[model samples]
Target chain A: MTELKLDQALIKKVISATQNGLPICERPYQRIAEQLGIGEDELIELMQKMLSAGLIRRVGLVPNHYALGYRFNLMTVWDVADQSILALGEKVGQLDFVSHCYQRPRQEPDWHYNLFAMVHGRDEQEVEQQVAQIKQLLGDACRAMTQLNSLKILKKTGLRIRS
Target chain B: MKLSEQDRQLLNRVQQDFPLHPEPFKVLSDQLGVPEQEILDRLRSLEQQNAISRFGAVFNHHRAGASTLAALAIPEHEIEEVAAFVSSFAEVNHNYQREHEFNLWFVVNATDQKGVEKVLNQISATYEYPLLDLPMVKGYHIDLGFPLW
Candidate 1:
């Protein structure tokens, strides 16, 4: 069960501390708790609470895609039927290679990409093949598609939330 | 550096359903038949190798703040200069160059919509390029839980 209401202050503290990572140790949360001056049990309880509330997406390892030999990151966008997005989006999101998928606003005139999914692979061909598979899955419902290959990483930082 | 069988397994296992305990490492050790100390050390070393970006909670941006995926068609000549200016902002996280006329794309997250707009306006004015602020209308596949192996 999720928390009825999240404790805002505690959420900020836990997130800020673990923003970088949960320090690798015998008792990682315990170490963080000691710094926060809360008991290990309390820290764990708070973490569990946040995790349940859907605030914390996942409490686990995030392997660097590039390091894992997933050098190709294609920002694949599709113009799918608006009514069918909910049903179709969930299916696409479930794909193993598609790391992130969302239906974003369509900036008309210049941009009309609504459904966005991040496809990752060891190389461009692999990524394209995956995209083709998605295209096959989409069938006629899929209008236009574009594969935006990442050229360079100008910056990479996590989202900061201040309470 | 090649990954040992144990390392590969650990990497695959930790991607999803990681243990939730005072000593999660102990749980991993118990399951994998490895020492808890080794689990911790291996994770640390993997992190050091930049293989594991981090082992922690991923916050939901929609719940926590106002975020948008904005793109700018920066002139080829001004790519470097423009990228520097955009990446300078703290709110601007995950900036990257893509192969397109509307080349540079970045995600901006702020505490509120006002803050998000402020960043968008600044970039729009500075670069003199139309910024396509494409905020998520519906989130279908936000979770990226999958097996690495």
Candidate 2:
């Protein structure tokens, strides 16, 4: 976690405002700062600090893959040996086709998959082909894996830090 | 939506190395060899069209707070009812129906593990279904945003 010691109230306010996203204008920081009644320079500096602290991942446009013609998305989960899972997860995360990769806790008995990677492609066949490549990449290390395609997206929004 | 070459370039370009300046659109405009107003208009239009989900920081959830990927295996008749119930929580960021037997999947986020547990237990009891709580252990990706092209 990012070690934050600044005014917690200010940070919370900033978080709330950022939920609407930065203004799509030349002076977005200024607009947001004005609304929060803080100096623009201070706001920018604080944001920079947050970026360095890993509190904020990026300050940019996040495009929708579906709108961009990459129709198929799959949550590819693998049951990798816990001992070597860390090493394998890091390697798989670096793959260009794999986005949002992580090691997750396993639910025993019924579920054993832990490592997760989100694979998006132009089509289902493309996604399957990428999964095949990942299989080859994992080689003997991957014990088992499965691809779960979304039958429906009830809601697909990021975590909202409400005011 | 048919993306013009310029729109495609803008989408593919801004995923990484987005400027932090007060006038980031200016930097994008410079990169795309267009006026700042054009970049602003394009982004606004893209967002309105739902082509851009968000236009700011995509924070690391675990770093920001606690989160868990949870699932519930509900019968077909109860799918809609359960999905709606799960989606009602402000804590649930993502909820989806998957093809697996453990069909319903959702991510719950909170300030701490206790908060997460509170919601999980409540959901489990209210819906009368066992939730497979899979908290994230570690991140392997910097999430250098997915390539749009």
Best prediction by TM-score: 1
Candidate 1, superposed: residue stretches over 4 Å from native: A1-4
lDDT of 1 by residue, B1-149 (tens): 45777888888888766777998889988998999888888888888888887777788888777899999998899999999999999999899999998999999999889999999999887779878999988787675455665
| Cα lDDT listed for each candidate | 0.84, 0.83
lDDT minimum window of 10 residues, candidate 2 chain A: A1-10
Question: How much is B93 displaced in model 2, in angstroms?
Answer: 1.4
Q: What is residue B78's positional error in candidate 1, in angstroms?
A: 1.2
RMSD of each: 1.7, 1.8
Q: What digit string (tens of lDDT, one per residue) describes model 2 on residues B18-103?
A: 78777778877887798888887887888888888777766767777788999999999999999998999889989999998899
